[model samples]
Target: MTKGRPGENPAERPRAAVMEDVAELAGVSAMTVSRVLNAPEKVRPETRARVLAAVRELDYRPNSAARVLVTGRSGVLGVVCFDTTLYGPASTLFGIEQAARDSDYLVSIASLPALNRRWITRGIDRLRSQSVDGVIVVAPHESAAEGLRNLPPGLPVVDVGGGADLPVPVAAVDQFAGAARATRHLLSLGHRTVWHLSGPPNWIDASGRVAGWRSVLEAEGREIPEPLVGDWTAHSGYEIGKRLAREPGVTAIFVANDHMAMGVLRALRETGRRVPEDVSVVGFDDVPEAAYFWPPLTTVRQNFGEVGRQAFQLLLDRIAGMEGEARRMVEPELVVRESTGVSP
Candidate 1:
């Protein structure tokens, strides 16, 4: 194999492998080698296999820039997301990469510092400048979803659970449904009233959770207490949890995220309350550590990978000039564990 070792017997610059080298090794014209790489069907199987064998031996990779010039397609997809290192967005990003690589497309990313209309518009503009065939915006905020209206007409965009009333297509977890299910589970457990510790107000996910929790309470004709807000941080959860733990009717709580739930667990312990005895807690985003938390958190599981994969699928359909925009919604499941139990 001519896969030269980079630092072997160091020289000014080791020779770079090229298609001509592969062509020469295969005993074929350069055009035949090109056909083998781009349109192998046009060449006889035997000849194509021979060219490919030489290509492997020489460690040859075609210049993507040159290939794009010839084929109008960059074979690249752009993903736009927010700056935070939150699990949902990060996992969704990972899912996008996995799906893109599997589909033989390269990925480019643009992370916005905030999730506002102007910032989202700027993020889209930056990706478009890279000549991306399409973009998938990992927008979990209501405002960011609204910004999709300003997208360049027919740019083939997909919003990853952005929110309601978006002009573009969406692929997302049904945040409202997931939250409602969690609330219902607690209500069914005989808790008279279930309290909520929500994420930041601007995020659609946080708002949806609050709405779901409130809807169930209202539906049952139970008292609808105001939701305590957190910034999706364990620290925020701890802060709000301390306050909730002191309240008389805070026997059950549905937190917005798992990280926050951990904090609440600590707060409850500090306040002389025993889990599943005096209080029960449920969290969202079944993070890996949720199971290891004291009392093993009960939570909602958002299929983040599914959200990402479906988003890519919707983007693919749009990029191919399909007739209409399609919004794909994935439902979440309620996971019961030690943290949840029959009301004390």
Candidate 2:
């Protein structure tokens, strides 16, 4: 009977004491007792019950810190993200959080200022201090991918969107396919050519969408014009739309995201360009407001939620040393609405 320190009773020394007692009473090793606590499925049912009963009798509570020390896993996932206010990133994070909750894992979010290497490295180091099991990065910029290349070896990582080349798994929406679909849909409505208003060139999603749009036009032998670029903002879209409204031979337009499309809509209305009649419009990322736009926007709906879930799942798989491809792409769907009409 060893005496505990001040303020500690020998009967209730701590979780370690209780676990040791349980192991002795159940005639099992301490490692076996720990296995039963952490992964009950690994232990035989009868043995598991015996250990559990012993735990109850001794009033034993498992020590999470001790478990982490033994397993070298914190059971926590770190998420590094940017654009927290944006629809795509926010929705995706929600899905990831939900999935993590379902799996009994905790998430710690580190919002990076930008996708620069310094910021990303800092975020990673911060998460590492917490001893997270793995990390999920949710920036979809070219710079983000470049930053990921600098990470140390053997750390499991999952990329949500950033076109950044990743060492671990990567999950994202198929922006190119979605853009192609949008373009083809416009052409089908008898528009000779569909103009494009792109997001910042640095974003991987923006680049993919632009590529898809160009590929469709080039395949049909339609003349491709210089794409108007915006900064993924409604105001930028509006500015580009104003200029586009005055451009000769422009009848249909494909904007990169819904927010910009709203701005385009405003510009079109102010310029007296009747939507779907004089000029049809299609946008990407069917945001909540896309439906409520004066005329519902015909836009591509990206599966951001699915991206988040898949990103987390992929990271978990990598952490568990499962065999699978490191890259995954989610497909986006085109939603037809009042914004597009048959060419007169």
In TM-score terms, which candidate is top? 1
Flag clash pairs in model 1. Answer: none
Query: What lDDT tens digits, residue by residue, belong to model 1 across residues 1-344?
Result: 65454566475465666778789889999999999987889999999999999999878989877777777678899998995387898999888889998999888999998778899899899988877889999978877866787789758888887777788888988888999999999999999989999999998899988988899899999988888899989999999889988987788999999999999999999999889889999999999889999989999998999889999988888888885757788999999999998898
TM-score of each: 0.90, 0.86
Which pairs clash in the backbone of model 2? 139-162, 140-162, 145-164
Candidate 2 regions with alpha-carbon error over 4 angstroms: 1-35, 39-61, 164-166, 323-325
Worst 10 residues of 2 by lDDT: 6-15
lDDT of 2 at 278: 88
The residue ranges of model 1 lying beyond 4 angstroms of the native Cα positions read 1-29
C-alpha lDDT of candidate 2 relative to the true structure: 0.87
Steric clashes per prediction: 0, 3
- The weakest ten consecutive residues by lDDT in model 1 span 3-12
